[model samples]
Each structure stands twice: as structure tokens, then as C-alpha cells.
Target: MSLLQNVSSPADLKGLSAPQVEALAQEIRDFLVESVSKTGGHLGPNLGVVELTLAMHRVFDSPHDTLVFDTGHQAYVHKLLTGRHDFSALKKQGGLSGYPSRAESEHDVVENSHASTSLSWAEGIAAARRLSGERDRHTVAVIGDGALTGGMAWEALNNIAVDKDLPLTIVVNDNERSYAPTIGGISHHLASLRATRRYEKVLDWGRETLTRTPVVGAAMYETLHGVKKGLKDIVAPQEGMFEDLGIKYLGPINGHDTPALEEALTLARDFGGPVIVHAITEKGRGYAPAASDIDGDQWHGIGKFNPETGLPFEVSGRIWTDEFNEEMVRLGAERPDLVAITAAMLIPVGLDGFAAAYPDRVFDVGIAEQHAVTMASGLAFAGMHPVVAVYATFLNRAFDQLLMDCALHKQGVTFVLDRAGITGSDGPSHNGMWDMTISSIVPGLQLAAPRDGEQVKQQLREAVDVDDAPTVVRFPKGDVGESITAQRQDGSLDVLLDVQGNPEVLIVGVGAMCSLALTAADKLVAQGHSTMVVDPRWVLPISDDLLRLASQAQHVVVIEDNLVTGGIGASLRSALQEDDQWQPVHTFGVPKRFLEHASRGQVLEEVGLTADVVSTTMLDRLGPTASGRSD
Candidate 1:
């Protein structure tokens, strides 16, 4: 009676009748809502793809067929079908991963969460199969319409089009959104395709009418279906984009209809070439709360919430995003020359308020980070200071563009990197740990890591004022917390903690790590060791004050929320070494390794970033009797 529990693998779906499959779909949706509500995972995207993913598994032999999901967040349904049913500890350490993990199952092929990459992965996999002479094996890439806006997707499409013999099937899951509603030309094309419902209706009519008449009538209808392309040209003229590219095109199929999805996918599996099976599905189909969300982002990636009311249990306080959101609105009013840009996330990066107030000034370039960065450079060339807001991890996509277009040409573009540092639950790919390291390599790029809400506002203003080069203001994921005021200003450095005696320990905290640095300094002070803590507002171009302080101290400690290697701490140590000021500098930061999924606090504690740990480590480095005076 329980269709979901009985169905453990794709093999189990083979024996089930059409009615059973339909029941299983509803079961899957109910399971998703209940499980994800408790665990706080990607509920909406998974719900939308239930029927689509079910149809794929039922049609193709996965693990052998090789199905890759673009932006693997939607692979939750895929995970369930492949025997990973426990959703109790999703996105937690020692539990199931939010994205597809190779260690979890053989069914998952690609695990990268970055969007617009499935087409390229499919291309490579399909090409390898061809060279290996594995004709029976097929490759399927389920890419969202939002991902199609990316330049890499187009590049892969161009490559795949030329290879008619490549055994690849591209399913464009046209959900009409990626966080926000998808923008640009690809979305428009998909919208046009969705509008051709008349053509589908006519075919359905012909099939029903012809089958009833007789054998001759069925034959006539089959002939009509074969030449439906010419008929489509007359009826739906906007339908040849994929066909023109030498890839076989099939249906603007209803993605939620399991039977209809099966028919389209089966045809694609047998086609033996690169085919684009366009599926039109809702972002949030079954769940009433997600489906009714007007702005379309609340359920995209949600926190733990009540399934009945669809509200979070705890009300969030003013976060890092809130500060950025308020400041952007104020900045829009003050500076007309300030324009805003986001890859596709207008709402997520705190530009929604700015867009609402000054609609003409903000641009959502879809899921194309490279284009957004270079376009910002062009806007800068035209005398407007463009603010490109994006997640710190995503900034990795446009490194060459930032280095060559913005920095090389001397463009004044402000990059607001939200969710910087250890973003624990989303896993390794989502963490913003590499921005400081990567941005440090770029010449004339001034980077800032804001300590609190007030500093996020202050540093953002300073970032936009630079007209000769690019600037970056990065902050972490959660709450901004209590603001830490400075005891004294030391030439652009904010000294939060200073001891009366001659300081032996000099602690330099970068951005959000300043609070932790001050806490660690207090621990040393309580132990009768004089310690001084300072935050260099602008982390780059290692300040004269920092070098002067480092020279006077017996031990220099630099802590940051970025990669220890090549981060600001490393840069400061290198600067000190270059100046021949060897005060035995110690750098503290995220280790240069892929971290597992956990809470931010849990990850920090594991990495020994706690106040107690840091102070004890510093004390051990200094002898037990060591104090303000070294000897």
C-alpha cells in the first residue's frame, strides 16, 4: 500500500503500474516537504523536480546511463530514489550532503553546486563514452533555464551541437527561475516555447481523433506527426533554435506530468544523439506555501521551519545582509553615479531594496558572473561606479575577468562579497574562504573585511570612492552581532584592545575575526601578558602602522576568516619578512583544505579558532614565565 517505502531503487519502479507511479510521485512530494521542513534543506527545487527526476530514473538506467544535475541542490529527489532515505541529519557533519556526493552513491556523477556546469560535464562524459566505444551508455544533463544564461552553457552547447553522434540528452528544466526569476535572452526563448501550447493541443487532438477512426486514419496521423516540424514552422515559428544547432529538439513538455515526461524522455534516450528535452515545470509545484510565495525566493533555500505555517521558529535579528541592504538604499539616494549588478541573485545579495527604489540603476545579468564583472568594468569606463554584489564563492568564476578587465584597465568597481568565510551548512563549494587569497594576487585591488554592521557601511562607502582600481568588501553569512568599538585609531587601524605595559603580543584581526582576536587578547591579558589587538580597515597594502607595531612587539599574531595560505595574514608576514622585521609572526586562518558541512561555530571550533584555543596556543609558543617584558 505504501508506494514510497516499497520502492527502494529505480529497479523497483519498473514493476509498478502507471497509477502506482503517480501515487509514488505524491508520496515523494509529501516526504520532501515533511523531511526538508525539519532539516532545512532545498525544499522548493526538490519538490519541483519530483516528477521530472522520477521520469528520468524510470526511463534511463542511472549509474550506467550517467545523469548529471546542474547546480546539484535539486538532486535531493535523485538522492532519495538511489537509496539515501535518511533526511534526519541533512547538511550536517557525518550525515547526508546537501549536494550530490560521490562517496554517498555511485548514481551521482557530478557533485559541483555551481550552476551552468552540467552541459559541460555532460559533454565531457558523452565524449569519453564515444571514445571508449560504449554505445549503449547514455549521458543526461538536467540544466535549469537560469543556468542557460551563463556563457559556459552556451560554449558547451556550441561544442555539443557540432557532434551529432554524441550520446547525450540535455533536459532544460525550465522552472522560470534561479533564486529570482531568470533574466536575459535564454529565459525569453523558453517563455516563447512555453507559449506554443496550441501546437501541443492540436497534436493531442489529432492523436485522439485518428486512433478512433481505423488503421488508415492512424497511418495518416503518424505521417502528420513525422512532418510536425514543417507544421510547427507555420504554427509555432519560434521553435528551431536547438534544431538549427544540429541537436534534436523535443517538446515543451509539462514537467509535472509523469506520463508525459516519460514519453518525451524515452524518445530522447532512443534518439542516439545530443537532444534538448525542454521541460516546463513550476519552481514550487505541490506545497501550497512555496507555490504561493510571491517573491519566489523564501522557499528556494530555507531554514528549519514549521511545515503547517511555513515560518521559521526563531526570528532572525539584523544580519550582515540587512546592513548591506540598508546601506545600498542610502547609497542609491546619495550617489546617482552608483549602479548595482548581480549575476542572477538580485534578492539574495541584498540588492532588492536598491532595485525597488532605483529600478533603472540595478541590473540582474542572470547566472553569468563573468559577464557581470566585465560589464561592471564597461560601466566603470563610462564614468559610473558599478557595485557588483555576489557570494564570495561565486566570485571564483570571474577571476580572469576581474584581473584583466577591471584591474588591468583601472576600473572602479565595488564587489560586495556576501557570505564570506566559513558558510558551514552549504558545504565546501559554497564557503567564501578563497576571495581574500585570490583578490590579494590582483594588483591595485583594495579588499576589506568588515568587523560589524557599522563597519560594513563605513568600508562599503570607502570601497566605492576609489576610482582608479577595483575594491572588495566581504562579510560572513549569519548575524552581524554586537558592534566592537575602537579604543584608539592607529592610522586607519582600529585598536580594539591595548594594554598599559609595553605590549609583547600584537594581534591583527581581519574583518569578522576581530571579535575573536579581541577575546583571545583578553585571555592573554588575564594571564598577566600585555596584548594589543588591531583591525586594519583596509586589509590590503599592508599599513605602515601595522609594520611599526609588528616591529615593536615580541610576538605577532594575525587571524582571518580566509585561507591561511596567501591570505592577508600571509601577506602581512611576507611584508614583515621583506622589511627584515622578524618578530616571529604567527598566522591563523582556515586551513588550505576542503572543509566538511557543519555549523559555522562547529567548524571554527574544530579548526581551533576559539578564544581559549588561540590564547593557549600563543602562551605555549611563549614560555610559561614569558610576560610583557621578554627577559
Candidate 2:
């Protein structure tokens, strides 16, 4: 049997010897490489944490111990060791999730896919354990040093250190990158210390010897310690950052070494207060292709690729991101006042090309989404048109800023929200379905959803040109639909299909859902049921003409890719209800629940937003009417 087969849980890991553990680490890496290559899940982060995860499981009793993983993409190895060995269906429907799932395993105590939130969770769990009068149980949080850039992690650290004696082990996994090379003050500080090798060695030796010295005793020790303070001032300058915060700081240990990780974790377990073990690990360590690349973002979350060739299985088509990037470049060229900003998502949001072309205009505000939004607002206040491009999920972190800072002020900022709907594979935390629902509530905020490539460029230009209030143009993560090139030059709405005159059923499609609506319309047309498909480019400032068309139809079916509650459909429903002539309407979209990890197609099919399901549902609704029975 393989070394991995012998391990079912952390308890099973306790029986293995040191050499056996070392062998298991290699086995796990091999399994990870093979599995992730086929499944196209998180490859680089998981590869770096194989030994660290093994050491963690060996040292701590999970579930009981309350071990939390910040940005749980690195938990794949943890998932493997905890009896989830089926990587064939990783991130698929009803399979192992890309991140930790509460339903998947008891070992996964927290379900966090976003970074910098684990420490806060650890603090609460640790405090709860203490409140219940339990002392033996440990609460450990494994957070990346990159995640430390986020303000929430520091807030947790500050709160946990208030007591100065709280038992919490914070493992700082310093891979030097969170998607991209980590930026900001904390990362710079860590980099400075990592560069000064001799200073670190001296400090380690001094701490070890000064506390254990016996010959000098009381008087001599105190005298020497006083002089040693001056010596430390000359040697290690910023060593007191964590110490002053009332948290013990341990070595920048080698994270790849199982023995070193085991030793550091053992010492951390014995330490009677809040402590951080700073471990330096190489992201994508075992994989040669990933290791050789300086930028880890390409390998961060990848699709199915060949292990030998390192080439992905499929080539991405011209996505909405491409059109956004191209248009932003043209806008910058055309208008000197146009500026673009991103919250550490330059590549994913297609701002990399924009950044490269106009470095001065593009700002990467490092994991700080709140700052990105407010900074853009500030730019807007300065008479500059600032376009803040961010992921739909990450925008949730800046809702307060969006509402108070941007909306209340009515700042002329344009938000280009990529992944604006049900982003399938990354699971609940990463889905962008909430953007429409949340942003719809913000007063004076104009929202647009383009159905195809041509509309994307046109809408983006219009959003940038709107100087009155905040405008948001959101699009999905995949390829753009067929280009709609023939729009009336007078800004009149283009009708893709018009059954408005004598329509039995009118389907209002939003953004990516237009294709599905068109398919449903085709099915209805075959069954001799008159149907109209309208793609309302602008979602907000509810289209009056479209509503009028809906009033003319027998029934209106609103199909969107966002949440049902408080989404575009809800707004439309409200508009129709206020109107006296509009008939009954039914809304179809993602349900009000956390969707699991699956392909985009799978999630759409399950939610009844696909062409087949939409067509079927519409046909069912018009069954008696189509059969000429007016009962």
C-alpha cells in the first residue's frame, strides 16, 4: 500500500516515524502533482504546503484542536490526509470542493476561501475555548504572510495580543505571494528581515543564550542585558514589531523541511501565549515549471494542464475582460483624465495590459478593496474619471465604502466588476452573484450588463463618460457572446428579436443570460408560441420600453445569473408591480443559498438558467395556452 493509503486522519498520522513521515511527504507531493494536473485546481499553493501540512497534522489534533486555514486553497493536502482522496472529481459538482467545505470533512473547521479572515476566526474560537474553561485544546491559524497585508489580520492580532497570554499559534506561511508577489508595508518589512541573515542569526543566538545563562546570575545578567539592548539596536532594528504587540515571534524556519516545521510547531504548542511561527516556503516548490516562474499568479489557480509540458488543455477565447482591457486602453489614449485602479487583480480583471500600456494611470492597491474604492472616489472628486476594476466577490469587502464613500457623495467613479455572476469552480466565497443584489440597493448607482463583445465596449465607454454618479458595468468570467455590431448610431436600443406586438411570452435577459433567453425563444417559436427576447444592456434605471413590452406580453419571464432576492429580477418585479398594465411575471436565477464548487455550466444547468431548462420551464408555463385550451 502507498504511504498516503495508510493515513486516514491526523490520528493515523501520529503513529508514523520521522523517516516514514518524510516518505509520506514525497508521496503526497506526487499525488498532488498528478491529481491537480488532471483536475485543474490550486496547484502551486498546495505543492508548497505538502510537508507543512503533514507536519501540522502530525503535531496537532485537528477538529478538536481547531486548526484554521486562511484562504483555504492550500487545504487540498489537508483534505487528502483527512480521507478525501478522490481528486478525479475535484471542484466538480458534488465532488471535493476547491476550498474547505463544512459538509466535506470535520477537520475543516472554517470555510474561508478569501485571505486574511482566518486569524479573526482563530481569535474567536480561542476565546470561546477559554470562556468554556478548556485549557488543553489549541487553536492554530495558518495564514500566508501575503494575507498579513489585509487590515483584518492585523485587527485580530491586536485584539488577541490585548491579553498577551492567549494561546493561539499563528503560522505565517511566507511564500512571498498571494496570487501575485505580495505588496504593501508588512511584506516589505518581512522581506527586509529575510534579507538580513546574519542579524537574524545573532538575534536567535542572543535570545537563546541570554535567557539560559547561569554563570553571570542576577547582577551580571541584568548589567549585560542593559548593554545588549544597545547591541540589538545596532544589529536588529525592526525586531520589536511583533514583540511590542505582545505576541512572541519565532524563527523564519524552512517550511519545506518536515523536521524543522515539526520542531517549530512543537515549540509553538509549548509556548504559553499568543505566538507566530514565521516559516519561509517556496510557492510551487516541487513543480519545476511553476518554481522557475517569478510570477506565481499564472500557476495560482489553473485549468487542466499537462504535467510534463505545463500547457493548459484549453485555450481561452476572447472574454469580456479582453474587451474591457482594450477599451480602457483606448479611453486612456482618448482622454487624459481617465485612470484605472485594481485591488491586486490586474491579470484576472484584464488590467495587466492597461497597466503595461499606462503604468502611471493604473494603480494596484494590494488586497485592500476598501482603499481601492475610496481612492477611486477621491480621484473622481479631483475631477479625474477613475475606473476601479475588481472581482465581483472581492467588491463585497468594500460595500461600506461603495455606499458611504462613493454613492452618498455621488462620486463619478466607474466600477468594472469582473466575474459579476455565478463564478462556478471556486465555490461560495468566490461567486460574484451578490454584486447585482448589493449594488442595486445603492442609490444613484447606474448598472449595465453587456450581452456581447460590441455591447461591452459601447457600455464601458458610456460608463466612463457618465460623470453624474457612480456607474457599474459587470460581466461574467468566460468568453464574450457574438458581437452586436449594428446598433442605431442615435443611441436607440437595438432589438435582437421583436415579438413585442403580439407576444404571448416575453423573456428579459440580463448580460450573459441573453443567449439562454434566445435559445428559449427559439423553442417557443417552434411550438407556435409567440415569444420576444430582449437584452436590456442597462440593468438599472429600469428600461421603460422593455417594461412596456413586458406589459403587452401574456407573461414575462426574467432570466438573470444573479441571486433571486434583491437582484435585477426583483427590481424589475417591483417596477412591473407599480405599473397598472404589466401582467404577472416569474423570475428565474440563482437561489438564495451558498452554491457549492462546480463548473459554470453545471451550476447554470442546476439553477435552471441554461437554454434547455429555461426553454422547458417557459414551455411548461404556456402548456394549456399552446394546446388551445383556454381553461
User: Which is the leading candidate under lDDT?
Assistant: 1
Q: Tell me the tens digit of each residue's lDDT in model 1 across 1-631.
A: 6888876788877777788888889999999889988889898888899999999999888888999999998999898899888999999888899999998999987778999999999999999988999998999999999889999999999999899778898999998988988878788878988887643653465446556666432133335445333233322222667756767777788998877777667556655567788899888789999987666789999988898888987677889999999999999899999999998898889999999999999999988999999999999999999999999999999999999999999999999999999999889999899999999999999998899999999999999999999999999998889999999998888989977755889999999999999989887877767789999989987888888888888899999989999999889888889999777888888999989999888888878778888888997787655434321
Model 2 misplaced regions, further than 4 Å? 197-240, 484-492, 500-502, 623-631
For model 1, state the Cα shift of residue 564 in Å.
Answer: 0.5
Stretches off by above 4 angstroms in model 1 are: 198-238, 626-631
Error of 1 at 150 (Å): 0.8
lDDT of each residue in 144-186, candidate 2, tens digit only:
9778877788888889878655778899899888888887788
Instruction: Find the 10 residues in a row with the least total lDDT in model 1.
Output: 229-238
Q: What is the TM-score of each candidate against the true structure?
A: 0.94, 0.91
**Residue 137, model 1: Cα distance from true site in angstroms:** 0.5
